[model samples]
Target: MKFALSLLVGAAAAQCGKRSPSYLTWTADSFIEHGVEKNFHYTQATLYLGYEAAYELTGDEKYAEWYRNQIDDAVVLEDGTIKDWDYEFYSLDDYRIGNNFLWWYERTGEEKYRKAADIIREQINRHPRNQAGGFWHRRPVYPNQMWLDGIFMADTFYAKWTKMFDNDNTTAWDDILKQFVLIDSHTRNHTTGLLAHGYDESKTAVWADPVTVNRDSGSAPLVWDRAVGWYFIALLEAIQLFPESHEGHSILVGFYKDLAAALKKAQHKSGGWWLIMSEPYPGMEGNYIESSASAMFTYGWLKGIKLGLISKGEYYKAAKKGYKLLTNRFVRADDECLLNWEGTVEVGSLCCNGTYEYYISIPLQTNDYKGVGPFMLASYEWETY
Candidate 1:
């Protein structure tokens, strides 16, 4: 009787605190404010997505306004170009935030927002590509490189951009399709049906294959946590953007669903994914269960299930368990606040890190943005469904 009463009380308490996830509740445990080397982290898209999600869930005007300000701040006015990017040395990673501009433009009728998005999209168009029609991750500075992580970094943003204003641009659609084709060609390992961490287009870098130019960066070669997270999220976002009439929509959705199934299979039983996804030899450095990647997988699975791309029974249950483990052990939550998220989650690389220790060795810091947006997104999905 006592146990039942306690359970009831706990349940009631949970109900009382249940609210759709809001970025307002999330305080950056560490901030890049005041010129603190902000460029080191991939900014823009993920951060603005947090604010956009907050606006959607809470109807908070402040987040919407702040996001608009961020886009305005990032505009680059060099010699002759009114651009949102420095393409000579830029990565597709930053443009993901461009999706927010369209929504803001719709809300405010601001051509500047639309213009800013156009500028970014144009930058994507004008940027250098490798021999096979794939983007060169950033500039030649990151020469001969194409990380699996780069797929979500730009392509999802590209799809959203196309959805917004390129309904008539057949060439734009062709470009988007080509981008995916290039990624599928470079990263997809036909044997395991998983992505390698990245590929070196030139095969010249130390991490590159001297023969094929692919990055033989990690062990197992099954999949990596963060890299796979990028793939799943890209599929989810891109699928959402796909027009119903497109012949490829169903195919992409099927791929996403299958990827989710594969990911569920790879999830560590303790409710996370290993740094290196496949079962590994005993001495791998960072192959243990990782936090951000686990949270991302949980977010992806929950989002996929809620989006009707996957079944709820198993995916939902797994997400719930993963959330529990994250909140109970990995997360430092007090009074509805989260702290100490694992900041740098990189794996499937034989170079710098691929062992369980390397994954865990990336310091658990307060409110890293990598986990923040995804956790908030997952929580919002939880609240809704």
Candidate 2:
């Protein structure tokens, strides 16, 4: 088994060289030259995470240097304090970039990175939670709501901080586990074996069904693709960080397996996932395969299989098929050798009682950070497979 795994890794490494460094460098430079205003957002932070992973996969110092410069531009200040980070809003999205801070701290042993990470941790310490102990996606306005995106934004960082700084504190693990359990219990649609985009604990969101006794009651109207993608990746990342001996490790692994099984069943005939994943069939108006979510799910599958959390064969087949689809359908190269990713939804969110039309009508953009970030991550994972 060990020999077989090493062969797979070796083959994957050889394949890694075929990926375009010029494309990655162009992408990073584009974001950097635009100045920090465009670069400091959480969306850009996600792309940086992919660049960091690419650095490790390809042994390229430029990718690593790009990751460092991006984070430093966002956080490092003259007084050694991390700037432009808002702890008062209590939004989980704000903490997503802290993953880069933690990564850079470990890479360079820099105190500034640690200090920047502390700022995010301080926000999590005070973030509001619903009655069931799930952290609210945001505060004040979006009270009592748990968006699937929040799990990836917050829990992974929390888990890593506990592992690195609070090794003796088991309570953090319990808290992290509770977020997953509550979200799963509330958002799951048993009929589809998939999770909804968001849950309203107050059952007051216009998009939520206040009267239904079905499994999706009090949840958003649709099973959004990218929301679940964020969650799927979060589970895999948390498992990677959690100590195997910890009680929660097996539980996280189980959750990942369940999600993987459901996602496998939902993959489109074209080897991608739809904008609304549950709407996989043709002639479903406004239902088209989306790039970002497909890439994210692919990344999760490849990483899960690589980590031994998922069985091989079927999952690997799905990942390879999806990766090919991404390359064939969404990826295009410019004359300058820069890659452009297409078919990504510019943005989607639940606002009051949003309809299926609302989701389908959202603009499709090329090379959006959301799509490009996951594409890069998926590419790195595929090459390392």
For model 2, the stretches where C-alpha displacement exceeds 4 angstroms are: 1-39, 78-80, 210-217, 279-283
Per-residue error at 359 for model 2, in Å?
0.6
Residue-by-residue lDDT tens digits, candidate 2, 1-385: 1001111322222244534343344445444554434344678778877677667766778767666665565566635466766657888888887787788889888888888888888879899998888898988878899888999999999988888999678788889889887887777777677888888988888887754324545788678889999999899889988888887889888888888999998988777888886544323865788889999999999988889888888699998888877776776544444455678888878765656777887888877888888887887787766
Candidate 1, 167-238: lDDT as tens digits: 766676667666665655666655445555666666655545432223442112335667777777888888
Q: Over 4 Å off in model 1, which ranges? A: 1-41, 66-87, 190-192, 209-222, 281-285, 334-364
What overall lDDT, based on C-alpha atoms, would model 2 receive against the true structure?
Answer: 0.76
Give the Cα lDDT of each candidate: 0.60, 0.76
Question: What is the TM-score (0 to 1) of candidate 2?
Answer: 0.89
Q: Indicate which candidate wins on TM-score.
A: 2
